[model samples]
Target: MLLWNPDMNWIRNPFPPAVLALILAGCSVAPVYERPQADVPAAFKEAKGDAAAAGNADWKPAEPADGIARGPWWHVFGDATLDGLEERAMAANQDLQAAAARLAQSRALQQDARAGLFPRVDAGVGPTRQRPSPASQGRPDDGPSQASTLWRAQLSVSYEADLFGRVASSVNAAEADAERSEALFESVRLALQGDVAQAYFLVRELDAVQALYRRTVALREQALKLAQRRFEEGDIAELDVARARAELATARSESLGTARARASAEHALAILLGAAPADFTLAEMPLVRSAPPVPALLPSALLERRPDIAAAERAMAAANARIGMARAAFFPRLDITAGLGTEASQFDNLARWSSRTFLFGPLVGTMLTLPIFDGGRRDAALDLARARYEEDVAAYRQTVLTAFREVEDNLANLRILAQQAAAQDEAVAASLRASQLSQTQYREGSVSYLEVIDADRNVLQQQRAAMQMDGERARSTVALIRALGGGWQAPEPVASASPRR
Candidate 1:
């Protein structure tokens, strides 16, 4: 009872045009998303007396991050060598490159998800051969074989209407995934830069230690020469000369140990710079005596500043989007399909308009699927999505808490190290003065060589301690900067008020 109507437009275009328009504003089954709250303090607990506030605006809990490009934070130290190392790390670090590649993958996936919002079209040309049975031909038992090649050319199209927001939810999830990947890439870059600066400082600190040992070795040699000359003059015993020689040997041994440590530190720094140890050499440079002051930002701003926290928050959003995607499976899904083509027994007739064929829409064609039963599959999937969202929520909160802890830990380190460095400086000065007094007393024969030796040992130990404390202070300052999202400037000195009349 089917009749061909050349003028029937509905038979050619089965998909309702209104569905396409509605898809843009499709109803999504996903739950409304909100950033889970965390316990963020107004000021860092460890930003006590030594730290100054960054004077940033008050808290923004769930505002999307502006970005992670905080500028070249390592420049605060004013070291050209460190600045160069950081530049090389950003350009060639393997981990950073890997993170970039992962980000690209996430963006590509987002593109794939966006594709679901539109229809698919395919074109093809092929040949078909078939023989019909006697019953199919409505003929006697000995029907003739109707085997023949049918040349066909076709253009087929299919589209899934976003009736219940399945496609929309998928698109939202993909967008969130891409954002999270970008944030993770930034996190890796910040960590890499921090590593380079910290490693460079550690190497320089060892250089200072080596220099201290060298000075001690030279001083011991000088003392040994003086003890030998005094022994020849019959002013000091052979025992005194032996003691001086022992001191010289001990200093040389310590010097070699320090040299070994420096070599290891240098090798490690070379790897961080993405170079072979044999090809890298650092001309010795002592750690700077003073650490630059780094001001602290308030805890509220720290949330916005750290890339890891931003990434965690985005993960929560992606999980929330997926929950909606799972819920959409419970609703009806619409698929629209259509095909237009030409077929003829002979290849020469396939191009003729009379041989045109077309198919569209329902009756095992365009389908609207309603899941009447699937045992517990849909229920399990919905539950799984919800659980994932909760897990990401916990992860996001933990990241925030960890960031706060890191900031406080580094702040405390810098403050305490500053005080320790000052005290160590005074000890070095006092020890040097005591050594000089002991030497004068021994040359005048007012004291034995034992007192002179003991005094010299104290001077060497105190000076080395001072050098170590200096390195610790500098390294702690770098750590604080990293915890504060890899960069912060010292507060400008308050300008003096204009002279009152």
Candidate 2:
């Protein structure tokens, strides 16, 4: 157990000189730290007007459902495969593992810094054989030498007297850096999760598109066969057969392209999940039709929820603490050292108390060092610290601005895409109807095969467009959630009772 003694006077102390010195070395000169201010908006710009009103009914301001775990925000998509992939990524992702290791390294460095506040004790023992020259007796120029074994054992203790807060300031700076590292780890984790989700969704979207193309290829092949039969039966021209075959080839080429895209997306996801591309595979799964409702939150909450913002804030604190450490270099430093040990020339008498010799009588002393000249080293360090603080402040503000922009951008995307999806749905239905009518009229000899071909192509294009829009809406929804900081929340403060007057 350690005791705290605020009083430094050693005159009346019953303890030894070493104890007194240790107790009085706690004074520091570092200034108190305060968080810097950042400019923030009352609300998001795009959160107003139609964007907010349009999705107001669908947006839920309450906490997410229990079935969808909060910290793993990807669970809200309700896809078991996605949830599994996220879990695997969190456990094995190399980038996240590296970030965690960095955090641990920072914590170890902080521990080393905190050790400066305590005394360091070390002990050592050594036995040596030495010969002494006898010429010092002045009896003869050449004389015999006497050999003896000497055993020496000693213990030493040292503590910095933090009289100017250099050690304390350094510790504070290290602690702040450790905290910054922790936030950075969390930032990396969030980014990894987001990347995995985005890549997975892309793969699923490509699957949907590829499936559409496959169906189109099959239908066009059938149409080609029908045109070939009609041309052989003298009912249609060779031009009709050629057009159908060309459309069929185009559909097949598109299907192959979509397959390539899906494969690329899958490979990207595999990398994010920390698996080899050749060894990893994701089964075909379609994206969920409806996007999970996003909870409404105040703009100020973003500052607290985003890990990157927290990291920036911690960086500013570290820089601020470093400034104090730099300032401390301009003042005097005090160190206290003490040693207690025994030395003996005879091995047989080494264990005996009478044979032990005290080197410096408890060996207690204080050292004060003042740098009268340093060629502006301290001043440069102070300037650098202040400059870093300013840089971190700028970065923090910029991060906040970028976060707001992302939220607004995704909100606009989701809103406009919703409208476009509705209109495209209607267009697809109309094209399908037109294709059916043209096919029937062609069979009844009321129109040329050209009308049927054009109608079929229009139907396929409209359907593909509708599917693409769905994929966009899903991707935008994921982006919006990521921008909202992925379900992070500040801890609730506990209420305390009022003190009596």
Candidate 3:
């Protein structure tokens, strides 16, 4: 029933005339991004007494070249030990390496999605053999044989043309996801830096405690000597000598405990830095005298600086693209295919111009898919995408709120710890004065040896407390920096800002 009419135009290039027009109209279906409103309170729940009032807007914004360093924020600590640890971790830490690999995978997937927006082509050439089936009848009774050999070559081209913009929308979604993964990797790196610094401070604190114990033990030995002399002279009971011995024994035990704690901290630091424990050793670092002041940055700045917030925002964009892609699926799709080739019954004539053959067609095949008969699958997908977008929006807001709360928490801690350290210093001084007075009175037979023993014990305990607070305040300061995304050195200081491809 099919007839070929030579005068009828059976082949036409669809892309040059019709498809290009459609593609220009349907380049992308994805909606442009508008940031969702954050539902957070005006101020953080834990923010107190001028903490929320302090912001970068109140301080001087840096010059274009004066912002925080983009890489290696830990350098601000000015400690060589910390710098070396971060370097080792970046090269060898397993968690960081895994995050980097995931980022690469996402980039590759984005490229794959981008490839779908373009035409595809293939070429091939080979010897071909054809055989007519015995049951198939044509001019077979006089035909050559069961099989015939020929030379063949062909080039085929196919293109989807993306007349509905579905392909472009998908590409947008993929690109956003890739950006999110990179942000996540940066987040992991920042968190690891904070952990290493905390562990390092803990080790040094133990060293200080052990040193304190050694001095206390020496004082105890002198007290024991005085107590024994008094017992021999029948001036005091043997109980005082026994008490002195017990105090010395307790000091020795405390020293042992401090050493054990320091060793454990060292091992933990080694694992974090991705090095063997045997190869990593830090000479005792003195406790820092004071914690750093909390850097001033506004609530809006927190959203820009934190990597988790960046990742969450990107996830929202990807979800929005899915909605456009799903909506576009309801429309029709058009594709075009073409082929050119050379064929010959004889090998010598295969490449000759006379043997060339070509075929092209403007195939207007349209897919008309309706959701009327589905088991609600299309609706479910749309619903899921919307729900995910809502969730991501909520998560983004929560991340911002948490960042503000953490900054305030550390600020209060730093404030109170400073006062505690000052008060403990006074306590230690007073204890020293009491011990000196008691020693003089005992030598003059004005008071019992018990007063001297009590005074020395009080002094030792107060000094230990002061040393521990110094380390705690230092650790808290590091936490504040991490919470504020490492000293506000803006790599990209605005939300939704992205690098051009």
Candidate 4:
């Protein structure tokens, strides 16, 4: 019969001690994480001007129902082709796929870190045959040693006590890292969407310019024919015909260049959609000159809206947690290992109660692993963590600054470009009128053909410039949407019930 000592019972069961240690170690040493302060302005600098102010007053704050769908901001442009391309890019873009994979990896690492908080249990069974040396046993070597067979089955459990919050800190760091990765993934997705939209706009713009040049080429040919007829009739000099031919050739060259630009833009769009250039083609669609109005959000909203800022903030939190982990390294660590097993001389007798010899107990140990003599490894690690924290803080600030700058830049582009487009429209109208008057005068023999050629060239250039400006406005609108975080919002946290006492 085995006599049980009540006092030793606790020693044989180390789980109670481990639980108490874990409860004590629940106190975290990591600093409380607070988002670093950014210098934000009350209003966008460009949004304060008279033109912007008047425009803002005329444009009501766009409600979700009145404006583009928040989930797909590209819908605001009301372009079906753009919507289709964005969908395809999201489905097949390699960069987005890689970012998603990284996010998954970070989540897996978080799970691995979290596992440290729980006990690890393992079991094994094996049969072993061993021979002891007679010399080691202090016996005279006379014959071959006899082999003995031992069959054993064992189960073991081990758990770190987390005496200094190392496990908790590690888990926190991993969670922060995972959050950072998630933010980065969102950032990449938003960037891809923006790229597809911008590229699509650019291709359409090129198509419009190409059409304009084609028309200019026809007009120049007509003017050349008129010059030739006038010269043949001896009503104009051969210099006029030569000049007309030169203008026609120039127009044709421009038309060819425009076609090349359109092809290049289409190729770029195809790549954005993860397709080969040769396999992809876009129909000639007219440029959408009207940009959807964007609601002006306050500067503070940028902090919550920007994904890069969120990532930087999470990185800082992770770095701070690592510092706590490094500091915990200076303290004592507790590990508890317990095992239960049965050993027998033969496999047949291993399961017999009489033949079984059992051993079960805990081996509780505490290790004070202070790096006292290391070549400043601990100090260097701690310093590195702190430095990384500082770097993240600076990066967070910089991201916020950049976010603000992008919004301001796009806002200024839209505002000033609107005024420029108006002026350009007037220039185009005036040039058209001048070209018509010059042509009539040259036909009436009241002016030279050179004047008519100059007027026609101005009209073509002005019209092309106007079309290019429209494209710019559309592209800027997309940029502003991207700068505003592509309408992505942080998910609301679910509230958990209070724990029962």
Q: Against the true structure, whose TM-score is highest?
A: 1
Q: Point out the higher-scoring one by TM-score: 1 or 2.
A: 1
Count clashing residue pairs in model 1. Answer: 0
**Whole-model Cα lDDT of every candidate shown, in order:** 0.80, 0.76, 0.74, 0.78
Residue pairs clashing, model 1: none
Better of 1 and 4 by lDDT: 1
Indicate the residue-level lDDT of 20 in model 3: 60
Candidate 2 lDDT, 1-501, residue by residue in tens: 112233644423546776557447645556566766677778776675444554433233544221122355666677888889998998879998888889878889999999998989899888889876777656466777678888877677877777767888888889888877876776787788888888888888888888888889889989999999999999989999999998999999988998988999999998899999998999987655666656546788777767677778888888888888888888877666655555678666667775554332233433666788889998998899889888988998888888888888988887788789889999999999999999999989999888988998899889878877877877787788778777533222311110101
Whichever of 2 and 4 has more TM-score, that candidate is 4
Q: Which candidate tops lDDT?
A: 1
lDDT of 1 by residue, 301-370 (tens): 8887788888898899999999999999998888877777887778888788888877675436337678
Give stretches of model 1 more than 4 Å off.
1-4, 7-25, 53-68, 131-144, 362-366, 488-501
- Lowest summed lDDT window (length 10), candidate 3: 58-67
In model 4, state the lDDT of residue 135.
Answer: 74
TM-score, one value per model: 0.89, 0.85, 0.84, 0.88
Ranking by TM-score: 1, 4, 2, 3
Q: 24, model 3: CA deviation in Å?
A: 3.4
Clashes of each: 0, 0, 1, 0
Query: How high is the lDDT of residue 282 in model 2?
Result: 95
The CA lDDT at 400 in model 3 is 69
Q: Predictions ranked by lDDT, top down?
A: 1, 4, 2, 3
Error of 3 at 358 (Å): 4.1
